[model samples]
Target chain A: EDQVTQSPEALRLQEGESSSLNCSYTVSGLRGLFWYRQDPGKGPEFLFTLYSAGEEKEKERLKATLTKKESFLHITAPKPEDSATYLCAVQDSSSSNTGKLIFGQGTTLQVKP
Target chain B: DAGITQSPRHKVTETGTPVTLRCHQTENHRYMYWYRQDPGHGLRLIHYSYGVKDTDKGEVSDGYSVSRSKTEDFLLTLESATSSQTSVYFCATQPGVAKNIQYFGAGTRLSVL
Candidate 1:
């Protein structure tokens, strides 16, 4: 079965601390991987999309890198504004072509100022 | 931000009552999706519409129904709300130009008593 798992269910870091979140997947054929940032009581906001292995995307203090079996979201010197639940989702090649995605449980990060 | 709106930003209902949530997108995207977010379950797809009158089930579609009568509106209905159905629901739209990238709305929080 196709599935996504994210590590470090919750993390608390002092401001300016760096950390990495992991998203491991098991799918028949990987089509794409997506990263989203969600604030409490709000919907998810799209961050980046990785289509193939070795692909990387960056925005501000966040960088996402993808590999054959997993993806990593690296936060460099994160601030309190960067403290949000990070979500990882995967699209499989065998999906119905309507762009279905399987999501992970997400990693909750807290950056204390 | 993408032009997506979810109605009834918050709702409270009793079990066995019927409820409907609305998702409207002004972008005219061909694909619309419904997902529910919970603490440990992350985001799970409930249903999706590819076009007007074309809808399909997702991994967690049971007890739910969806309709897309026009190009801009998609509705998700719970024939009889249950306590288990209480969750934060999100709506997403995928622009045809980049089918893999999805934009989301603010989400609706539902509570079932």
Candidate 2:
């Protein structure tokens, strides 16, 4: 079974603070690791996709890095607008045809200005 | 935010009633998905469609059913609503299996009272 686990369920950070969210996973074979941000009352927004270990992707103040068994979403100098629930999901190679995703519990980030 | 829209942005209904949520996409994507979000659970796949008339269940598909009669629309129905079914539902789309980037709709908030 494919599973994703995210740690530090909730975090409160001051504006411009830098931190990283952790996502650990166990899968038969990894096809992709995804990062998403979701705000209250809204669906998730895609951020980045890392296809292999040692791969990294970034968007503005957010950066995502993937390893064989874990992934990290690093936020650099975060702002109030960056406050949202960060989600981590993985798609195993076995699901290449179906494109199914197994998601984590997510980390709620609050950036205080 | 990707030309996808979910109807009945918010709904409230009594338990035991039947309910259906509609997801419409203008991108003409070949794959569509339905997922639910709740506290302590990031997002769990309910069902997904690979193409018109081709649908399959996901990990948490027990109480949900889905249909895709057209490429641009996917509908998820709850046969019998229960209090535990109250959640924020999201619809997502992907261009194809090789490209796993998924774009999500605004989401629908359902409350089964």
Candidate 3:
């Protein structure tokens, strides 16, 4: 069974604090790993897609790195505006044709100012 | 914001009633997906459509059915609503398998009482 697990269900960080969220997966074959940001009462917003091990992608204060067994989303000097639920999902090779993604429970981060 | 829209942003219905949620995309993407988000469970795929009239079940497809009669529309129906089905449902679209990047709608919050 392909599965995804995200650690630290909830985190409270002060403004300007940096942190990293973890996403680990066990899959038959990894086709892709995705990161998303979801605000309250809203749908998730796409963040990054890592296709292979050792691949890294960055956008502003956010950086995502992927490895064979896990992926990490690092937030640098996060502000209150950056507070949101971070979601991680994995696309198994078996579900490639349909583009199905198995998602994790997500990590809710709160940046207190 | 890939031009995806989900109807009935908020709905409250009784158990055993049939409910349908509509997802419309302006880009005429070939792939559309339905997922349910819940606390502690994350987001789980309910069903997906590869193309017009082509659909497949996802990890959590029980009691859910989907249809895509045209290129830009996807519908998800719950034959009989249950209390356990209360969730925030999301709709996503992907251009193709190769792209693998999915854009999401604002989501529909459903409550079954």
Candidate 4:
């Protein structure tokens, strides 16, 4: 069975603090890994997609790195605006060309000013 | 913020009642999907449409149905709403150019009493 798990269900960080959120997965064949940021009363916004181990992507203060069994979303000097629920999802090769995603219980981060 | 729009941003209905949520996108994306989000559980796919009149069941499709009669609109229906179906429902669209990237609309919050 393909499953995705995210640790540290909730985290409180001071403004400018750096931390990392983890996403671990067990899939038949890894196709893609995705990261999203969701704010209260709103939908999730796409962050990055990592396709292979050792792949990394960055945007401003956020950086995502992938491994064989897990991925990490590292927030560097996160601001209060960065406070949101971070979601991690995976797509397995077995899912026919339809592009179905299996998501993990998100990690909620609060960057207090 | 994608061009997707989900109608009935909030709804409250009784169990056994029929309910329908509408998703409209201006992006003309070929793929549309419905997902439900809940606490302690990640978003789960309910149904998806690959093209006009082409729809398929997803991991959590039971008790739900979907229709894509035109290129821009997709509708999700609950034949008989149940308390267990109360959730925040999100509609996402995948542009053909970015097969793995899905853009979401502000979710609809549904409550079944």
Candidate 5:
């Protein structure tokens, strides 16, 4: 079975702190890897999509990088506004262009002052 | 936001009751998906539709069904709600151009008593 695992299920950082969240996967073929940020009582927001190994993308302070077997979301100088649950999802090769995603449990980041 | 809206942002119901969650989109995306998010468990795919009258089951489709009779509307129904079904359900749409990005609805929070 295809699976995605996110590490450091919960991360607590001081305001302005920087850290990285990890997403590792084992699947037949990796079509894409995506990152999302979800706040409490809301849905996951689109972040970045990495299509292949060595691919990377950024938005504000969040940057995502991918490898053959895993992806990383790096948070730099996170502020309170960045406190949210970060989710990682991978598109399986079994799916066509219609697009389907397999997700991770998500890492909850709490940026405190 | 992609003009996606999920009805009954919050719901409380009893087990064995029938419940329907609706996802409405204005962008006319070709792909729509439903997922359940739970603590310790990642967001699991429940169902998806590629177009009107075209639907398929995801990894976790038990006790649930979906319909997409129009490009803008997707419905998810629970034949008989179970306590285990209480969760935050999210509806997402894939834009034609984004290979990995899926915009999401606000989500529906359901509680089964």
Candidate 6:
């Protein structure tokens, strides 16, 4: 079975704090990895996609990096508004054509002001 | 934010009753998905559609059913609602093949009493 696990179910940080959330997976033939931010009571918003090992993509305070077995979402100098549940999903080779995604539990981040 | 919308943002019902959640997208994507979110368990896929009338089950597909009869709408129905089915249901859609970015609807908070 393809599985995705995220660490530190919840994290609290002072504003401007820098930290990284982790998503580890066990799947065969990874086609792509994705990062999304979801606010409480709302839908998730797409953030980044990393396709191969050693690949990274950045959007403001967020940077996503991927490897063979894990992916990291690095948030630098985060703000209070950045406090949201970050989700990681994988698109395996077989689901590539259909756009099916397997998602991790998500890291709930709280940036205190 | 990518033109995806879910109806009945909040619903509370009793067990054994049938419930239907709707997801509509204006992005004209070819793929649509239904998922449920729960603490510790993360987001679990319930069902997905590659195209109209082309739907498949996901990891947690039991007790739930889905239908997609048009290009822009997908519906997820719980055949017999249970307390265990109480969850925040989300609908997502993305362009197939060359595109991997998934856009999600605001979600429907369903409480099976």
- Candidate that scores best on lDDT: 3
What is the C-alpha RMSD, rounded to one decimal, of candidate 4?
Answer: 1.1
- The worst-scoring run of ten residues by lDDT in candidate 1 chain A lies at A91-100
Give the alpha carbon lDDT tens digit for every residue of A1-113 in model 2.
78999988999999998999999999999999999898888888899999899999989999999899999999999999999999999998998888899999999999999
Question: Considering TM-score, which of the candidate structures 3 and 5 is the better prediction for this target?
Answer: 3
Best by DockQ: 3
How would you encode candidate 2's per-residue C-alpha lDDT over B28-63 as one tens digit per residue? 888999999888877999999999999999989988
lDDT, residue A89, model 3? 97
Cα lDDT, all candidates? 0.94, 0.93, 0.95, 0.95, 0.90, 0.92
- Per-prediction interface RMSD in Å: 1.7, 0.9, 0.6, 1.6, 1.6, 0.8
Q: Is candidate 3 or candidate 6 better by DockQ?
A: 3
Question: Candidate 6, residues B34-104: lDDT per residue as tens digits?
Answer: 99998878888899999999999988999999999999999999989999999999999888789879898
Error of 6 at B30 (Å): 0.4
* TM-scores for every candidate against the unseen true structure: 0.97, 0.97, 0.98, 0.97, 0.95, 0.96
What lDDT tens digits, residue by residue, belong to model 5 across residues A24-82? 99889988888989998888888887888999898999999999999999999999989
Q: Which runs in model 4 stand beyond 4 Å of their true positions?
A: none
Task: Please identify which of the two predictions, 2 or 3, would achieve the higher lDDT against the true structure.
Answer: 3
Q: What's the lDDT for candidate 4?
A: 0.95
Residue A99 alpha-carbon offset, candidate 4, angstroms: 0.8
lDDT per residue (tens digit) for residues B19-67 in model 4? 9999999998998999999998889999999899999999999999999
Let me know the TM-score candidate 6 reaches against the reference structure: 0.96
Q: Docking quality tier of candidate 5?
A: medium
Better of 3 and 6 by TM-score: 3
Winner of 1 and 4 under DockQ: 4
Interface RMSD of 4: 1.6
Model 3: CA > 4 A from native: none
Query: How many angstroms is residue A9 displaced in model 3 relative to the true structure, after the best TM-score fit?
Result: 0.5
Q: Which stretches in model 1 have alpha-carbon errors above 4 Å? A: none
